[model samples]
Target: MTVTVRDLRPEVPADVERFARSRHLAIPYVLWTPEAIVHRTTRTHPDAHYRSLVAEEDGETIGTAQVGIAHDSGEPGQGYLNIYVQPDRTRRGAGDLLVRAAEEHLTALGATKLFSWVLDEPGNRAFAERHGYRASRSAHFLRLDLANGALPPLQDLPPGVELRRAADFADDPRPMFELDAETTSDEPSDVGADLTDYEAWIEESWKHPLLDLDLTSVAVVDGRPVAFSAAYTDRATRYSTAMTGTARAHRGRGLAKLAKNDSLHRARAAGYKEAFTGNDADNEPMLAINRWFGYEICATEVRHVRELG
Candidate 1:
């Protein structure tokens, strides 16, 4: 009945599957596949110093941690570790063991500040607060019935605008990267991130295992991407909008809704049965856009921060 913390064996299929299962149990909104876990571990930026740890009790993995440095941020010493334990197995010291292991790993990497996402539940918040974490912004996980629900109709773009798919720029995704960078910088969040490294964005985002280029929709004006809705799907009929945004100059033109509707229609036509997405609570425009598409809040998470001296 003793719990121990150890490194997750990426090379072991069972270990990876168990970790994914544990994550699914703890957080069901996000998709977590065995291949996705391996891809993140192997393809993440080297500067990230990413490490996956697991808490084992009686040879069973009861908790998991995703610890890494936020290398994309210009700010240094920014690290993150999200620890989730199986509900039925809590209070067995798995969470405590996992946190100790994760903190030590990140501090060793010279991380001066740490961030984590805690579920918006009393016990979860209490756990983080007791550990010296302060609650920050909150976000909602939204879900849509892609197969049976009615999606908004795609509208014609304005005179200078056109719709295109991500695959259309396979030869050169720099334009999409530029659009993503602009839109993301303006996104409402507790921490503002800059996607300055185009090459790294291409490797981590454009080539992501879940990104379905054909299903993604982009708004092009004067042959330049100004808005986009990135699509990610598992071959198993689950689809999600990784990001949906428009450039600062292109805001208030309904272009975001236009691109999102286009992506939704294409996703449903391609046989995706369930759709998932998330948004910061303060993002009223995006939240309204999602509500217009019939998305409902299924879960919520509060961002918690802890400073390390």
Candidate 2:
């Protein structure tokens, strides 16, 4: 069986579906859809040089990779390549070929450092190590049974603060953009992003195919968004928190938890059954809040890095 790696044909519906399916089968915790994949491939900033690749065996796509330069990062020459192979299609040359293609693409674009997330399992880690990547920080994929789990009761709005849905910012989303930029800059990650482009955020995040504006909860103080929990849904039974954060000035007030709780309640009310979220292992505050909402760590992935010549 000859396995070949090639660029995903975004124009081909079947190819896009297969790529999304491969990702879902390999990493069930994260949300992936054909629309989301296409958005990431086409809507990402040109500076990112994003490319989605698929590994095919005989006429079936069995693996996928998202390769890109970290354009928004303050540091240059940092690139990322995340690969996933369908569970039933492993041990083939798909993974290695995908890696080779991804690395070559990024390296040709002047990437001096490459980062990848590998499942915490021994085999996955060994595979990354075999390709000269070393494990660094780790993150956890947390899941909550929104249908069966007991969510915290919605608390009365604190004085001077009001709860609002992300849709409320439809007429003017600059405030939401400001809040997102602030919170995103503080997120713990191997590559730091500077969200200074409002237009880019609108296209790449606010208008994302999976973003569920009606279910996204935000805390507003004096008409300004201070905290928020961004929601993403598969438009089915699955929901996820894309991001939950409090503005720097509002960190000590538990506002992030409040927003997230409100968002979760809204998601459950809207018929979402399962909710998934991910957090850096060192982000104790967010972890504590998720635990309070009955989320359990279902899986962990370690970030690995390799310096390219």
Q: For this target, which candidate reaches the highest lDDT against the unseen true structure?
A: 2
Q: Give, for candidate 2, the lowest lDDT window spanning 10 residues.
A: 249-258
Candidate 1 lowest-lDDT run of ten: 184-193
At residue 122, give the lDDT of candidate 2. Answer: 89
Please provide the root mean square deviation of candidate 1 (C-alpha atoms, Å).
1.3
lDDT of 1: 0.89
In the range 222-271, model 2's lDDT, one tens digit per residue, is 99999999999999999999998899998888888899999999899889
lDDT tens string, model 1, 1-309? Answer: 889999889899999999999999999888888988888887788988998999999999999999999887768888898999998988899888888888898899999888999999998899999888999999999999999998887777788899999999999999899889988887776566888888878878898988999989989988888888999888788999999988888888988788889999989998999899999999887898899999999989999998986
Report model 1's TM-score to 2 decimal places.
0.96
* Per-candidate local distance difference test: 0.89, 0.94
Angstrom error of the Cα, residue 6, model 2: value is 0.7
Candidate 1's error at 6, in angstroms?
1.7
Q: Which pairs clash in the backbone of model 2?
A: none
lDDT of prediction 2: 0.94
